[model samples]
Target chain A: MSDEKKLAIIATKGTLDWGYPPFILASTAAALGYETQVFFTFYGLQLVRKKLDLKVSPLGNPGMPMPMGMDKWFPVLGTALPGMESVMSSMMKKKMRDKGVASLQELRDLCFEAEVKMIACQMTVDLFDFNPADFVDGLEFGGAATFFEFAGESDICLFI
Target chain B: MAAFDQELDATGLNCPLPILRAKKTLSGMEAGQVLRIVATDPGSVKDFEAFSKQTGNELLESGEEAGKFVFLLKKA
Candidate 1:
């Protein structure tokens, strides 16, 4: 076998915050000359859709706790606030930018440039009634078996 | 005059970026050529170790200077 290792990522989360990890890791792995594949399934399909709408989950993400000062006072209300998802998403995006973290779009571009394979789950494609044309150019459409092939051979397998 | 066959300033870049860019740059170079790189990521010491090992490249020299991590690599 060729010495080039492989990385297979199962992307199941659909939120905007969740979107960053898969693309970031995929592109990074690809850049390192590792054969990289990202399998988008279930909610993760939104990431590959033609028109993407991503939002963060301030309601249940304990790791991304509520903003400073307010978390102490309105710990419960923070989760109940209206338009909280968008607010949290924008806030999180700003935080990432401040930390010099590349955006999801940038990471996707890097993945493409790095020759990382983007795979969409066929079951999800059928379930969502999305045509192959609905995704970014050059994406592969396949089922569990295809993903398993990559995952089985990968030195690093991740679920994002 | 170039001190090395190729030089890449990877300062301010973090893990994976340094190694990734290095890999890409090295791919374009002739085999047995040397590459000089500068980075600031503290984890680069270990990252470069794994990278060189996995890719079969030679880490000829590596050290820190002026707060920057310097590395010299010879492609396999």
Candidate 2:
């Protein structure tokens, strides 16, 4: 492996839980003094949105865990509940807070300060009707070729 | 012999932050420099462990004091 490394993170999910992985890894890589970039596509672009992407709640996923024990294991009952995703999302947020993990916003800010590159997928942006101005400052626009070109030189590539 | 002396006070900061700061600090140092970090976040222990593994930095000593965690790192 090269002593100096580059990393590319592909973000495709918009949920709070899903969002943490990419930010966490990307920030960590930047902290390690590696050249890092996070490419947001599809729903993942929500994170770059100035307001709509902040604090996403999993409101509709039924596979989320129940409040108490045992009920989580029941087969069909688990799938029938509403707001299960919200519960899971809250649980994840709580766990992170309790464990002293940085907030999503803090991680993002740290990444920017550390000069980690952030990119948005142009096709997804157009499809979602997202204005480039709606995203955080310093977001670049590109597609798969852009991502591949960046990833090809990196020692590590992660899709989250 | 002292390689180099650096201190990072990450008290009240969280997991990745401590490790993050440690990484940034180490990056500017030459091999064999020593870094001392004090943190209040509990997850820092595990975070540093993983950091040492991933970055090849050596954790010379780590322990708890006055409800705070302290780590001595040797850049490798």
Candidate 3:
């Protein structure tokens, strides 16, 4: 791939753990002067929604660090217990906030300030019964063709 | 602390935040200006290296002092 300083990110997951990568990378790419676009598809539609404020599911996400003092087999512990995902999600958010890491909403706002193009998948939005008003302004709506048009011109295409 | 045209205290921020702040700070600076950024994230060492390489900015020096990572970047 050539060093064209452009990045196309395909965001297909909506969990808090998965949410950070696309927004984080997109904002970072814009900061580094890259033309950045993040296309949210499939289950990723939740992120574009206004203030759904999704949580992390420790049962399925292995990358999330075990909450302080929790066992390494936290997922197993979560499996043994119900509503553990909310607990895990809160602890993770607290840890991240205390560590000075920007929150998901903060990162998303930063992306908007950076002028990174955000696209919502048309099929997913239609399937989910979400209208353009359900999302914030300055977003483009299109299907796979829109994403493909962006990916075709970029030097780096990341699927996260 | 070093002599720099601009200084960004990215202390306490992790990973991409430090880099993003540094990039924002450097964007307003003129070419050849040196920026000193203090970051607490351990990953910033390699991240800055790659960022400089990709963006054509110059990394004049980088080191850990007093438990914080310090980076000197010149706007390219």
- TM-score, first chain, each model: 0.90, 0.80, 0.88
The per-model lDDT (C-alpha) reads: 0.82, 0.80, 0.86
True lDDT of residue B16, candidate 1: 56
Q: Which candidate, 1 or 3, has the higher TM-score?
A: 3
Write the residue-wise lDDT of candidate 2 on B1-76 in tens digits.
2334898989877757898888878888889889989999888888888788777888887789888998889999
* DockQ of every candidate: 0.37, 0.55, 0.77
Report the C-alpha lDDT of model 3 over A1-160, residue by residue, as the tens digit. 3554789999999898889999999998898788899999988877877776888876654555675647654546554477787887888889999989898888898899899999999898889787779887888898888898879999899998
lDDT value, candidate 2, whole model: 0.80
**Cα lDDT for residue B34, model 2?**
94
Which prediction has more favorable TM-score, 2 or 3?
3
Mark the 10 consecutive residues where model 2 chain A has the least summed lDDT: A52-61
Q: Is the docking of candidate 2 incorrect, acceptable, medium or high quality?
A: medium
Residue-by-residue lDDT tens digits, candidate 2, A62-83: 5544455634565555544577
Q: Candidate 1's residue-wise lDDT over A1-160, tens digit each?
A: 4678899999998888789889878876776668999999999988887677778876765666666855677676567688877777888888776654666776677788888998999998898787878788878889999999879988999988
Q: List the TM values for chain B, per candidate.
A: 0.92, 0.90, 0.95
Clashing pairs for predicted structure model 2, backbone only: none
C-alpha TM-scores of all predictions: 0.84, 0.75, 0.89
TM-score of 2: 0.75
